[model samples]
Target chain A: MQKEKPYKVKLSIMPFWSPLTPPMGIACLKSYLEQNGYSVRTKDYNAISSLFDFGGRYIALMKSYTPVDRMGNIAMVGYDVLMAHLIAYNNRDDFSLNDYHELVRQLILNNFFYEATDEAIENLCELVEQFYALLAEYLINDIKEKDFDVYGISCYSLTLGPSIFAFKFVKKYFPEVKTVMGGGIFADQFNSNSLELETFARKATYIDYFLLGEGEIILLNLLESNFKNVPRIIVSDKTVKKVCLDDIPLPDFSDFDMNSYPQLVAYSSRSCPFQCGFCSETVQWGKYRNKREEKVVFELRSLTKKYGKNIIVLTDSLLNPNIDKLADALLEVPPEERFYWDTYLRVCDMAEDMEKVKKWRKAGLYRVRLGIESGSQHVLDLMDKRITIEKIKSNLQNLADAGLKISTFWVVGFPGETKEDFHETLDLLREIKDNLYEVDPHPFYFYPSGQVDSESWEKIYGYESIYEDKYNEMLMCTYYKLNCQPCREEIYRRLELFRERCEECNIPNPYSLIDIYHADKRWKKLHKAAVPMLNDLIHSGSAIVDEYRDSIVLR
Target chain B: MEMERKGIIEVLAAIFPNQTIDIGDDDSFIDKLGMDSISFVSYVIGIESKFDIEVPDEYSLPSKLDTLNKTYDLLGRERG
Candidate 1:
């Protein structure tokens, strides 16, 4: 008998977020590897019951070493601080009812903020120490263990701090395991020249390989070549250039436990055509290119067959450009199977094809999220949205007529948006309120590129800085100069006005609009206040806040 | 079976009066009801709210909710 494949690759994808299943890239790679006769096993570390298994072990050890009563007091104080940070973070984002509860539970055991400070940073180190200790113990106690040839850790720009700790821990304990890094965060950095390359390069000591762009193609190539010097990153090598989307395989959700998620996510296309000033799609994915329509249909049908009829969320930048093709494909599927779906579509498409809009209703397209960036024509033009007030009104009305729920994503502070322009947006919203199911208005985030050049940047923020990696750029804050006062104040006024309007109309703010400014002001008062609170909560030994559990939102 | 078909038609009529609700016993939901994902979900939610019946996780619209016969069976199962 032929000997079983020599290499048994135990692939693991761990994301800090709940649904940390391997993305399409990993799924495609899995399929490719399996087809080529490599024994592959993928574990979603995100789904493992205890999010803070490492942290919890540390706490237990600490408690055992110290007096039980003193440890209890320390744990209680830590828990209180942790709860405060959880409350503050959740309040910043409008979390759903269920998400808030889950976040609280996860926070109790998992130290999400452990990496926020140097003191708490030690806790993370201890946690990792315990994690490896437990892993070794498990291998000895449970069954015969074989070493994994390569261990890959996925990282997003936002979660870089925690990721670094996790990477270091894995490398320290399992020195034999080849550590590789890949994902959107790295891909974004490699594609755009704007990212902080020096910082990444300095931090590269821990990572063995940074598989840039679509990792499936490069990773498989690297693995098949027996870890030979391939085009992709091979520690101490220059970054590999970006790859095309066509090269990647369709993502497999089969390995994931889908029941944990509330919504089913599907992608019809990659990238957006329009150059919206605030969006990073263009910078990241390059120009828009859709997967073959048949591929999307097959994926949808397969998912429905496997998961039963579930809500399908189209994770496309714009669903309207290929609306006809999508509508045709959806029509082929039974309506019951297509029960509910949501997608972002351009307003222009809706205006052109009202009948198709109606057909979408027939095809079970429940929600259409339109990016009505601003009501002012000037602001809309400035953002390069290429839509008019008339088109928005007509498209919205048509959708309503077809019995489809409409959700509008509006931005309050475009660089040139005057107070009067904001009022116009409110007026526009009021006009379309009857036709809409919800309205989400965010303060304009001055992303690194688009219409905002050096002059525009200086005019808005009184400073000009080029974004090294468009993905990692700090875009959470708004910067603009009004006749007097700060632009953030103007943004707040617009948000307040928008909230007041929603209240007057008796429409519930799904995002808890008040929390935006509340959290913003709290953070602005003392920049480090929230960070320390978060760190304490993550390092805390017990559960803390529960009253405002329903208020926290995670995106 | 006729009674169940009538119940399904009644729900569809409430949502879409302009469109005709002529569907064969063997007809598909998308081809027959002229409903898409959005309307199908709205209709499902509406039925659940109106009839006070819980739709099962496995029940999909148009395809599964297509035939009045299948819907009636699912509804009975859910209600029971």
Candidate 2:
């Protein structure tokens, strides 16, 4: 008998985060492989209960081993609870510091029972180690029957540590499995000539290939030839130029369970119009290119039909300029059968098109997260934001009037941001408080390849401050006077004042506004006092949310 | 007592008006009535000032609505 044609080589793709279940890139590759007569399977490691079990146990172990004796009980518990409270509060200004303190107290007294127990710590560590081993076993055993050729892992900034460890463990057990890593974080951080990148590539021997940019075509090519001298592939001591976006196949999310993820992920278009000072998109994709209108509508129709009026989140650089096309496509959707959708858009675009706003609402758009950047005209111009305060206010009001929840992102402390500028931002928040469902304030982050840099940043701000490790490549500047040495107390004072003003105004406090600075100064103090208790509370709340999904908005 | 009940009722009504909301002395928030997590959180915050109870960590707020009513009962017990 003729030997059966080797079963189509099976390919598995896994995401490190749960809400990351919609593996669009992986899906695109899967469809391509299937079309080419290869078997494809995708898994979201984030949804695996075993990961959470490991995480909880690991958290428990860390809490138990927390050197309470050296730190003193008051400081230790206090710091842990404080850190946890900050994480739990997570950009909500509705609650007071008193509220956070009280919640931390209760959490320490109740939920943090494991932290005080040595037996619990031991058990948790054992469970974590065992769970990870078993997880490796399950993954390896699952693929053992299929005779898989390669495994692809999607890595993001938050999921980097977990995905790296998982990839290494999987490789150790199944040495034959060629592991490939790719994603936004992997591409941004490792796809360069940095000492850090070199170290990572050298250390992680298991990760055979790091497919930069879009992985679908490159991955397919690699698998077809069985990874023998592939083009656009990065291995030890080799670099490749960025791949063209058009060359990659459209993402297929059908195989993965998208419902398990929060945020309905979709991309109407890629590439950005404006090259903002701080954006990585400009560096990654090199300017804006709108996807073909017909292709976009076709994908939307397919997703809507399959997902049953799922919330369609456009992971686009800007969706406003294409309002006419989007509106026409949405008109095809029934009013009652409408799906909730959200996207980022330029304030200037929205201000110009009130009719577009109205159409979007009718099309069942629930939320629009606008990058207002700053309240000060000077700051806006300096950042090359090119949008005015009046435009922001008008567009925000228009969106809110159209019955859509508006979340505005404000970045404070850009280089050259004066005391007046910060106040202007606060004033703007106060002015627009009634119209906004939420307002998030993020501090200026310095990343690689931004308009702000050490030389330019110092010239603008007249300060010599070392950038954080995470933001070494970008230039970040904040307006807080306390940021200057010997006056950091003033920074705390201003932050507290900002928080108080937000509370008084009933506006939601942005995530990391106060905590980011505070952590910078006394991370150890805060981490020990409040982090543990707060984490317990957030996890507990998340658990309740998960258990009672039908009762809550759930997302 | 009447004023407090009215205040609580008004807040709950503002959040969920059309739905029939039953407040019982012995009923649990999550188990007996099934208030869910987000609603239960809002409920907790809305009543924080009224009850003179401080919940420092919103995360550690009881997962079970049953546990929440017990806290309410405890507050009542202290008052009584």
Candidate 3:
């Protein structure tokens, strides 16, 4: 009567991730496994976390984009503080309350935040422990519900610590269930020598296997081979040929609660052709590859029909690599079948193609997120972001004219950036204020391993020194010192100034809420009066802390 | 108190003209009336303008002022 299901596996992503859309990584893996005829299930703890009263607040922070500067991000600072305590507790059996208090004290001393009292730190530690147990209860209950053979946890940059916590739960509760870990975090951490990957595997004994690079092929290989003679850390590049975008099955969102998210997530392309110096996207995805336009259109039609959501968010690096062809393919679909989409774009000759852009608009390209890294040509050149300022301005005007919302990002405090260069960025913001829908300003972070040409950038700029803080076995922090103008303090001042300029220009930055909360904490650090004021603000039922409840419907 | 309640209903009606005509005082803005985040913010602004009272940013949250009764209660505290 029914076909027998084989090779039962459950793939999950842990909490403290964005609930705005379903995770694309797990969805892709789930689809690939099903296509290969393996029974697969997904546990989206990240999405489900929004249902809890406390987890809802965390999800809200996770949903908002944080700048590269961790201290400036209320979300990042809060997450890192809790994670530092959790990791330390996990490592030591005799870890005491004082250890957590000391750990938080170290964080405060290291300039992670302005200040926190001993009592506050103690209370926060208790709350985090309770939250972890609650998350584990949910995880264990789901695992117990079905006898899954393999449990895979997808680890992103933010979810690394939580995923480790999840693996511990799986090993403790269901020891027989094989634990596997994979995602962008591995892509960032894995080095050329394989030494780092080896060290990570040895340290995380709970994770039986690590699927590096893309998961679809390696995961299927592991399942088929029955985990025999497979390396504990299976690097995708070493194991299988680069996956053809055309051959891979479309991402399966059927496993996810599609109604919970505002927009459905899909990506037509793998990576960007342009190798910007400050970018790590190309590192994660080796080379640029795209599906055939026909396949993309088909995916659109099928996904829209199945999900009943017309607004699709493409997680592609840049959707306009082959703009003309893609636009034409989308236009081939009739008006009714076409669905609304938003994607990242580069300021290339494609923007100058007014007719093609109009076709893209007609074909449901409602938003274009542009990495206008800097308004200054000098900084742009230094970052190896080839697009010129003149071109950026023209493109913004063109896209805005075509009824596409131009969400532009600017980087503050790139190496060698001067006061005048910073001013040029401000001037550009003012110039394009009318055309801009949202302006997100982020501080420049230099991840030596992640960048394409950090050596060249460092040599040319004559940076003072690079500092790496290996806080624990798991977390490694990196900080760069600029020998040239605009020190870190000045850089932060510029970030605040950038926000002020946005307000003066009347640009509606949805991220302003998080920034305001961050500023309040900074003010608390500076003034005693700010302590009472902060308490008042928190007790007043402010949306900054309480709005997470409104972001999603309670399950 | 009755007049304050009427004023709150009038403000809600102005913000969401079509939805508020037959809305019960206990109807949740989000659940019963199907108000989104933006409309909720507009309703807050509408209440502030109509009643000539400044609603604190904290109290303006949808969870805090989701119903006419809640808005009426908030007004009593503000007036006091």
Best by DockQ: 3
User: Poorest 10 consecutive residues of model 2 chain A by lDDT?
Assistant: A473-482
lDDT of 3 by residue, A1-555 (tens): 125345688898876566556788999998888888888888787555222324324323332322334334333334544545555556544445555466656654443323556655555556566777777778767877757889898987567667888888779877888899888876454433334466667777899988877788889889889878988877766436777888888889877876555567888888678888777777667778898888887887788768766667888888777556776777677645556677899998878866666667666675789999888999999888888988998887777766566677778898878899999999988887877776777766554355676567657655532322333442332234545567666766677678778778866543322223333334334332122222222223212232211232212
Candidate 3: which stretches are off by over 4 Å? A1-6, A49-96, A105-113, A123-127, A189-199, A455-470, A474-490, A511-555, B1-80
Winning candidate number (lDDT): 3
lDDT of 1 at B50: 58
All candidates: interface RMSD: 17.3, 9.0, 8.6
User: What fraction of the reference interface contacts is present in each model, in order?
Assistant: 0.00, 0.00, 0.00
**Worst 10 contiguous positions by lDDT, candidate 1 chain B:** B56-65
What DockQ does candidate 3 score?
Answer: 0.10
1 against 3, candidate with superior lDDT? 3
Model 1 misplaced stretches (Cα beyond 4 Å): A1-25, A36-40, A43-147, A186-191, A225-249, A334-339, A447-500, A503-555, B1-80
Residue A502's lDDT within candidate 2 is 58
Model 3 lDDT at residue A504? 81
In model 2, which runs have C-alpha deviations exceeding 4 angstroms?
A1-21, A48-147, A191-193, A231-250, A335-337, A450-501, A509-555, B1-80
RMSD of each: 17.4, 13.0, 9.9
Model 2 DockQ reads: 0.07
Candidate 2 residue lDDT tens string, B1-80: 56655666665676566766577745555554445333554565566656775443322233322343455554565466
